[model samples]
Target: MSRIGRAGFKKQVMFVLTISSFIGALIIGGAVYFFETHQVKKNAAYLIQNTTRQAAVMLNDRLNLVFTQYNKMTDKTSLWRLVNQTYQEEDSPQKYKDILECYRDMKEIYSANSEIMDSLYFATSDGTSIPLYKDMIFEKRKINLEDMFQKNYEENYGYYWLNKHEDQVFPTRKPRYVVSLIQCFKNTKGEAAGYMVLNFKSSYIEKLLEKAQISENGYMMLLSDDGFLGGTHVEEKYRLSEKTIREILHKENENMEKEGFSIYQVPLEINGWILVSVVPVGDLVSSSRQFLVILGITILIILLIAGIFSLVSASMITRPIEKLTERVIEFQTNQNVSFPVDKNMGYEMRILAEGLSKLKERVEELLRQVKEEQEEKSKLELLIVQEQIKPHFLYNTLSSIKQLISMEENQKAEDMCEALSRFYRLGLSDGRDFITIQEEAEHVENYLLIQRYRYAANFDYSINIADDILKVKLLKLSLQPLVENAIYHGIKKKEEFGTIVISGYEENDFIYLKVFDDGIGMSEEELKELQTAVGRGKVREESNHFGLRNVNHRLKLYFGEEAKLVFESTYGMYTQVTMVLPKTKGEKEC
Candidate 1:
């Protein structure tokens, strides 16, 4: 053959070999990419599925813990012991004081579990129930044991629900639900003596779901086996619908009865109580596209170095983008929202990002409106509070006089009436928010005398006004309500003989007035609620007094945030409320 013919043949062979090799590499890369992408999606799906199951298991465990706490708080043995101590036998003054102590201790136990308790009650056989957990109060009422207690026992024996008022003990107007179980107490003869009720709040159980650390975008819910109970902290729309939940009820109910784990593709049935976990599934699988893009870029660079497999690398790049596009579409359809991506994305990615900016604008507008509305409401409420004090003083004064006249102490009572008049008149003395400690102390002393006459030595109070603090600037009426709470709930409720000791002194560039009382000390839960109420300045009408909330509010309003109230209490013994006041010059330490 001629030399030129041979050379031409060699070139044709080389070109054919290179093209074939590039095609082979492309085919291999395509196969690997497809397989890896499938594996990634499967792994992501598996992660989400397993996490859902685990969350379900944890949720069930937490619900069981809530039940266990409810039972513990409502234990018949302890409650009956309390009932017998309080009612069955006549108790000495000291013994009665001890009972209050025990009640306070029980409050601690319930307080520790308040996360799951809406409100707990100690209902006596006589139909009087005192709220021992949360801040619940029920007025004494006539109730039929069989109709209220027995019926509730049958209805709530083995289930949980949004609680209706068990009976007249809880008024119809209150907005609290009781998730409770009852335990029957026996007398010495083993007859049914009385019952102890364990009540949990719906919000408390919701807090349990919240505390489980469910993923921010994912949530697990506890549904009744019968489909009668269900709630979630996640957004409302994400919550499983009744139709969807009822569908899995059979399986859920069956699982609740069974002794082990239950799995079902369908979430509803009569026997199927479910742990339904919903997660943002697309967020979990984006790693595959990231890996594919990285792999394609590396292959393209390697091919460019030798012009081998360049076609294959380009095909690899296009393949991943197409797969990612399909996933974005699937996610959009399932979630009923556009994919959260940028609008300026390349032509292939524009669909996901188009409506995002408009959504952002709408969200911002909504937030702005919400903020303005909140501020306006706060201002209006504050104005109303400032104007409402006049009526409150007039009312408390009239009640005090009515009690004194009913007792027929016409002479000493007149002086008290005069003192009450003087106390309110002090508010007009200075338009300034601040007043002297002496003036504040006098206000409390007048109030205390009126209470002393009403409670008739249920409590004894002592005051020591430090000479230095007497003329120092203090918040008006700051000391009165704390002293009043000590007398009413702490002393009168628990002790026939209660003593409150008040002292004022200087400490660390500040003036402190200490009000310590040997009254019925509060349990941990009451103390927590009291602290929250103080912090938020919220007053509950059922908490037996509106004065403390108002007093604390005024103190914070006047004292520049540093002058405020602090308290400590031990059940059945003593509670101390401290007023922190900034010191003024020329204050003598008394």
Candidate 2:
């Protein structure tokens, strides 16, 4: 036989094939594992962002229909006189009887939307009024009538469709938390005759939001510059924080991932209100679980097969070796069939290959454990940052009250003292930053109320929240700075009655908090400049432009990039600021 075609060369080729096959299998298996894992996460992110945005837009359209219906009623009425001209005397028996018929007409329109309107009523400047009720009987129910306008009226006057009187110059004629609308009626001579009110059940917004969710189990909210209008659901103790609202409202429509949730937002067509959706990170993890298990099994099988092949190849490469003069072991093959193994051809080479395979397994395992630790670390760091509250707020508040007392303003000082007490009591975070969002809201509310007392009538503020998200937990003072800016910078400088609204609710897996002001909103130039500063992560100390550098830093530091501050404003119109945070429950710190 020719030396080039020797049987020894065939054995060498076989050995080389076996070793290469094993290596190839491992490379293929690992590549597939990592690529699949990344694809799963990518798909999960896409699902949430796409689904939430669609849901928001759909809900906004449906709610706009409801607003349109009420708007049509107003438009139709505005074209005609309020009191029918058939009756000659404005207050004669016939005229009063006709007026009842006229209000009944409005009631009929209200009844058309029984699903949305709890009751319908009309009130005039001089106190002549009408009401439609489900039971037509006055019943007293204990309610924290604290948020009368946002809960009942529009701030409501802030929305060009309604007007506010001093201390709600009108009576509470309907149930709590209804959409309150006030419209005026003029006579043929263009003289003011009277006004009408439409009390829409708050459910009108909630039901639509509930129905339009991409997932059967996700959080959603309806919010405006006046604050949280309503929500469909809330995660346990996961109240949205004001910082979160600033984040979302900073942009018109946003999809973001923060903490343990995927955040989505869409604007409401009627009120510049935003519909925000939150989906939990856990859900995304679960969505890819089955795929992971299958991929894991496939990878294990490939590794097992590779090991078996390697073992078989090692057992087969048995070409006789020249006897070692020094009695050392050696693998032997002829020159015609030579393949380099760095000159090491002993059985120990097979052992080394086995060790390498095992080493790769250990490396993968260590990587998995490291990944898990990274996730846990993220959660722990969140708790740590939340606890990092600045104590100056309490000190400053106490100082302000002390000054008021020293100035001999006893009644105002007493009120300030009470508000300060409540603020601290709610701020009682047990030296931790975490508290139920409801409590955090109350804390911020107390702060705003105190400011309201000090800024008396300069600007009015309101807090609106949905019931389900009340138990949400958040960091302390996340809201105060935004509201403080709204009062001192935006509203105080405005000529008319400016408003400070704080609202929080849950969306999907995240809690959304919004602080909006119907004050001197930022111009495009100023808004862009401020956003640029925030994007650069700078917090300016000046009160002008409602500096939010400090709040931005805190939110980003704790929540990572997902925690965001959003801003939206039209100079001379209104300013909306939002923040998004995790919907973690409980006040426990790590």
- Indicate which candidate wins on lDDT: 2
The residue-by-residue lDDT of candidate 1 on 468-521, one tens digit each, is: 657777655567767867877788788578788999999889877888988789
Cα shift from native, residue 432, model 2 (Å): 32
Model 2 lDDT, full chain set: 0.61
Q: Candidate 2 residues 1-590, lDDT tens each?
A: 23433455466657666665656555665666578766776787677667667766765565466567656655553224333343445446755655566566666666666776656555543435565666345553322212222332334432333211211322356535565555555456654455555666566656765665445346677666556654425755344677776777776547776655677776755556677776665555556666668667767776777677667655455432222311122212221222233234444443444554465567669979889767655654453343333366556666777887888878887888888888766655666656666787888877887776665557777899778777766656677767877776678778678878888777877767898998888889988997877776433344243236656766676666777889999988888889887654322332
Candidate 1 segments whose C-alpha is farther than 4 A from its true place: 1-34, 49-78, 81-105, 133-195, 204-217, 225-237, 252-274, 280-590
Residue 267 lDDT (model 1) = 32
For all candidates, the clash counts are: 27, 31
Q: What is the lDDT of residue 2 in candidate 1?
A: 41
Q: What are the TM-scores, per candidate, against the unseen true structure? A: 0.34, 0.39
Global lDDT of each candidate: 0.58, 0.61
